[model samples]
Target: MWIADQWKDYEVIDTSDGEKLERWGDYMLVRPDPQVIWNTAKKHRGWKKPNAHYHRSNKGGGEWEFFDLPDIWQVHYKTLTFRLQPFQFKHTGLFPEQAVNWDWVCGRIQKANRPVKVLNLFAYTGGATLAAASAGAAVTHVDASKGMVGWAKENAAVSGLTEAPIRWLVDDCVKFVERE
Candidate 1:
């Protein structure tokens, strides 16, 4: 039961009725969760006045109803910063839940006491890439979407790792690995 409790910019304020209310930095958002089967009372005030709400449709997909949201935002975890946006499929560009993994990856890299090279596949928005780079590891970040690769680069720059050893690649992971 790993919890990403180290986050100061993100938190799950409450969960009820197949939905979880989350606070991403200064904004609150209501998004559906399949695992929240309990129909508990939504006691949190954030549920009433969220910055945005993602309504899941029974037919297939869903849409976001925005109140006071922006096209882009930023969140921080330790020394790293991530650019976030509410995009397709109810996804924020950054996954706050993955902070535990980022912490572990940073710890392992720092403990190595030598130069470490990491290959991050499907590295969306460069969370792990930035963590590894911050820990002094040379990272190769690859993703199929050129836009996502570009987004990862933005995250890297925002985290002040513009001079860090990171190689950004936009290609299919399998083909990239096969060629390397």
Candidate 2:
């Protein structure tokens, strides 16, 4: 399994009782993680007074209990910027673990002497897409969900890549690939 540890804006502070304590930017959050089956000691300070805690419901969904938290926020990973909001399913509009992949792909793009073209399928929020564009590659970001594509666009603008060479498309990955 590839675990992304090279992150400056996000960190897993601790895990306990089927929950993971994470810090996104300056905000600390406690969210349920299915993989956290071990009952470890929650010794971290963030575990006790997190900015938000997602309380799971036996009925299938969950709700976030906020404590002095903003409705939305922004976080940075190196030169990339992402908007974060508490939404259904307790997502912060990003998977911070993907930072490692972004760095790896960006490095490869930079090393290549010629112009690189990237096709990001199922490009949720366009993290990799923006990373490639930021690394001087022309990128085509494709996602089935329009809302996610819009979110990715917002992230791109926030990262000062609004003028970057990116083609945003809201289409099924397979259909888009077949057309290309």
Candidate 3:
């Protein structure tokens, strides 16, 4: 198992009882985790006063119980910026763990010396596409949701990449790939 130890703005405050208490750039949130089965007491003080809690349902989905969370906000991973909001799905428009891959791909693109054209399939919210664009690659970002495609455009704009050669497409990734 590869472990990362370089994140300065995120932390896992505690994990127990099938839940993870995390701190994301000043906001503490508690969310469910199927990997954690031990019912240990949360030692972190943030766990007692998380800004939001995601409660799971027996029927298959879940809901968020917010405390002092804002309706929307922004965060950064190095040079890339992202909008964060508590949505019906347990997502905040950004996946920080993928920063490692972003850095790797960006480095490869920067060193390639040739014009790089990237096709991003299943490009939810365009994180990978934005990363490639930031690294000076022309990218075609494809997703099924128009809203997600719009959000990705906004993220690109926030990262000062609106003029980057990125083609945003609202289409099913599998179907698009098959057609291509």
Candidate 4:
């Protein structure tokens, strides 16, 4: 198993009784996880008083209970950036796991020495787009959600990559790919 020691703006504090305690940047949150079946003693006080909690419903979906959290906040992943917002679902618009992939892609692009043109399909919030742009590559970021595209733009701005050659497109990924 490959273990990653480097994590950007995210941390797994603890896990117990089908739940995970995590710290995203400065905000701490508790959410359910079926993989965490082992009951463990919680040591961190933050777990008891999370800024937000995700309660799973008996039906299918779940909801977030906010104790005290801002409407929106900012976090950074190296040169890439993201906005964290509490929504109906347990999502903060950015996936920290992709940092490994971003590093690989950026390295490859930099080593290529040629002008790289990348097409990022289903580019949610522009994490990959920003990574590629930061590596000095032109990118076409496509997503189905307009709000996600807007969020990506915000990320680009925060990363100081607004002038990077990134073309944002909001359209169905399948249809767009088929037309190409």
**What would the C-alpha RMSD of candidate 4 be, to one decimal place?**
1.4
Q: Per-residue CA lDDT of candidate 4, range 84-136, in tens?
A: 78675677777777777888889999999799999999999998999999999
Clash counts for all predictions = 0, 0, 0, 0
Error of 3 at 69 (Å): 0.7
Q: What's the lDDT for all of these models?
A: 0.92, 0.91, 0.84, 0.87
lDDT-best of 1 and 2: 1
- Cα shift from native, residue 31, model 4 (Å): 1.7
Off by over 4 Å in 1: none
Among the numbered candidates, top lDDT falls to 1
**Candidate 1 TM-score, true structure as reference:** 0.97
Descending-lDDT candidate ranking:
1, 2, 4, 3
Residue 130 lDDT in candidate 1? 94
- All models, RMSD in angstroms: 0.8, 1.3, 1.5, 1.4
Better of 3 and 4 by TM-score: 4
lDDT tens per residue, model 2, 52-135: 999999998899999968997999988989999888887878988888789889999999999999999999998999899999
The superposed Cα distance between candidate 4 and the true structure at residue 64, in angstroms, equals: 0.7
In candidate 4, position 41 carries an lDDT of 89
- Give the top-scoring candidate (TM-score): 1
Put down candidate 3 lDDT per residue, 35-67, tens digits, no spaces.
Answer: 998999787887788999999999978999999
For candidate 1, lDDT tens digit of each residue in 1-180?
Answer: 899999999999999998999999999999999899998788889999999999988886899999999889998999998899997888999888888999899999989988999999999889999999999999999999999999999998999999999999999999999999
